[model samples]
Target: MILYIEQEILLDTQCQDLYLCNNGLNNEYLLISSSNQCSCKKVQAIFCKYDHDSCKNRCLLEEHLLIKRKKQTNSILINDSPANVVLLNKNELEKNSEIVFICHENNLPSPILEHLKNLINDRSNATPNPSLHQTLIGNFLLKHSVLAQSAYGMYLKLQQTRDNKFQLRRHANIGYLLANILLGFLCSFILYRNFDLYQLISNEILIQTENLTTSIKSIIEWLMHAPAGLKLNQPLVDFLARFYFYHIYLWSGYLEVLVVTVVPYFYKILFILCLLGISLAIGAICDFIRLLTIHLYCFYIYAARLFNWQIRLLIILFRLFCGKKQNPLRNNRLDSHLCDIDQLFIVTLSFTIFLFLLPSIFMYYAVFTSIWTITILTVKLIQSMNQFLLQIPIYEFYLWSTGSGIIRGTPRLSINYADSTEDTVCYNFNFDPVSFITLYRVCNIRLSLFSLSFSKLFLGILKGKSIV
Candidate 1:
């Protein structure tokens, strides 16, 4: 069997012959070659020996070389003295490789070498291909419409205000921002034109606020008694229920007054927001809604604080019961302690009271927390929609779809082998349009209002930290 292997050799003026020797590994050979006598037959023999185990057919060997000459040397000459026999692994050969042009004359023509150098430099500095969306749209337009082709040609001749990718992105962002502002104005005008619709929306908001207050009051009353078939401390439940009821009553009264006085002028406030931008306007609306329902957030805060306080007291009392006290000098680590009888009695009493009251407090906390979370999520969804509108690249998408090269991304290089001769090679260079998807991925802010981990949120609530 015969084997095939590929290898690179470095040739210079001083080297002449080549030799192949096995390096005592599986199918690996070290080639020791000089410039003068390196030929096809010797390379094939080396390959056959390298793959002797698996192949019994003919072998093939191909060699590619790029050489560089010193400025002082004009002609190739063979050295009579033993050429330097430096053994190189693949990595060393790659590291020491240099590019040079071989010619029939002693020296290569300066024009040809300079042209090759220019090509290499141009290739290295060329822009990358356009984004995926741009390419797809560009191709579709180019394939189907002659009118699009003419328009694109005209667009290409027009001087570009945005000459680079960064400028293009900035221009697109400004366009989107202006578009959002215009949309906000349109929305505000529509609301202004339909006064009845605005009145209807205002009434609905007031109605929703009233309903929420009533639902919360009902929930508090139900919790005041035994809830979910669980026996709770009546005194503690009564205190919490009365506290929440008073706050809800105050909030409802405030809403009632606002409905009569402020609801009629709510569109004026929205029109002021619309002057800013659609995203800001929408975000303001969300904030306004949250403000109207602020009572729920207040209830959650009260319950969380009460629950957290009881839990902390219970933990300290538990440690005291276990005959341990936290030592301030030892970074608060628990240490063994013999408690006084009076202290022990107080600890036991406190722990029992806190433990009994915990269930009632916890139930309120959980209910209010869930409601607040849902409200926050709804607000975040609206805000995300606003953000999407503010960043969407509508203008760029239209330009790309019409085959306008103004939205070009990286320049693409294609080799035209059909145009190449023995003495010359040809290359074609064109710019691809930047994709909208790529821009969105890079520039769009994440839509989430809260990206907290579940464990972190749970711990925060337990510690009486406000999630908002």
Candidate 2:
């Protein structure tokens, strides 16, 4: 268990030994050599006081020298040829001096010892430690055994921590998906049962088909006047008019569906909306995970492309004559033109008021049609709270979705609108998350074909305005 080392080995004087000094004083041992520092220095001069024990004394001296020599052989000089540090075995250490230099190296606590035991035999209950020596075979086995034990304990603790975090993340994703599915089913059921609810409420004043057609015509007329209206300094009117007409047209179609269809037909529409909402919710979750999985992917694709908090804000301000750039340069005119296009989109989307302006109508439709959207949207927003004990206000979550200045994209995922520099402001609202998301992004490709055709028709008008 211990190693001995010596400074040097050399014969000295003042060594005294005696043997058969039987009866009448046979012989006397005498000490020789050395000055006052006799205790510190090696002694010399052995006396063969007795003949019988003379050989024994010589043997003892030789054995002592042999052990010391072994230690000296193992001792390495710092600047020696090999220059590598070598560990000493029992023989090498025993040859060293009685005083040995001890350095203790420590290991971290872990659970890997349990892993090792399980690997060897499934039925074995013994947990091994990293510091524990499984194959004890030498004089230093006791020391190594303790080290192995400590290592195994450390491994177990680390494994448990990793497992817990993974479980928590999985549960959160599952909760999100479950809520969406329930909402989708509920919405479809409601729509299937109450087809004529909207018609009954509006007292036929808003005949679904006729009203929707009239709204679309009015919106097209308003769109024709948008650019000129922007130039005439009637930009706000131009914006609101276009916004209102478009949303009314869209929602009116939902209302019209009830009178024109049977239970199955209305159910089909509800089913579609529910499906779209669920898809949006799923995409939102996927986007969140992808955002965390890769750093650059989060910034470029999700944050910049989908959310677009900065781009949308700049466009809004430029349309309102309050853009960031002062004294716009001729060279940067293209940038200003792009802002104008964004402003138009913003105006058109705001018309529905993100389902807020038409909440009564939407809720009636949902109550009568797909009631699941409200439930899904509501629960999802509530679940986004950072802490379970302190739930964030549901109204606050709603404001984040339907409120102006809240940029829309996917459900339960909205960001406060920011200027071109991405500076946060509390003034006017900019985008509607629900309408843009459920209407544009989540809908099928066929739905988009209709929208693109509508956009092209509007674009043709804009081109005509430019020529004039």
lDDT of each: 0.53, 0.30
lDDT of 2 at 306: 20
Off by over 4 Å in 2: 1-165, 185-264, 268-468
lDDT of 2 by residue, 1-468 (tens): 111111111121222331211111211111112112112222222232223255345646653211111122332211111111112122222111111101100120011112112222322212223333345552243232222222222233233323322222223223333344455567656755766564463445344346535644553454445333432224434454465456545555554453345334433444564553343333333333222222222112321222233334445445544333433566545333333767656655663342232222222222212222232333334323211211112323343356533223221212223311121121221222344323221111110100113365345322221100
What TM-score fits each model?
0.59, 0.20
lDDT of 1 by residue, 183-211 (tens): 87898787668756766876887788888
> RMSD for each model, in Å, please?
17.7, 29.4
Each model's total of backbone clashes: 14, 39
Q: Supply the global lDDT for candidate 2.
A: 0.30
lDDT of 1 at 49: 17
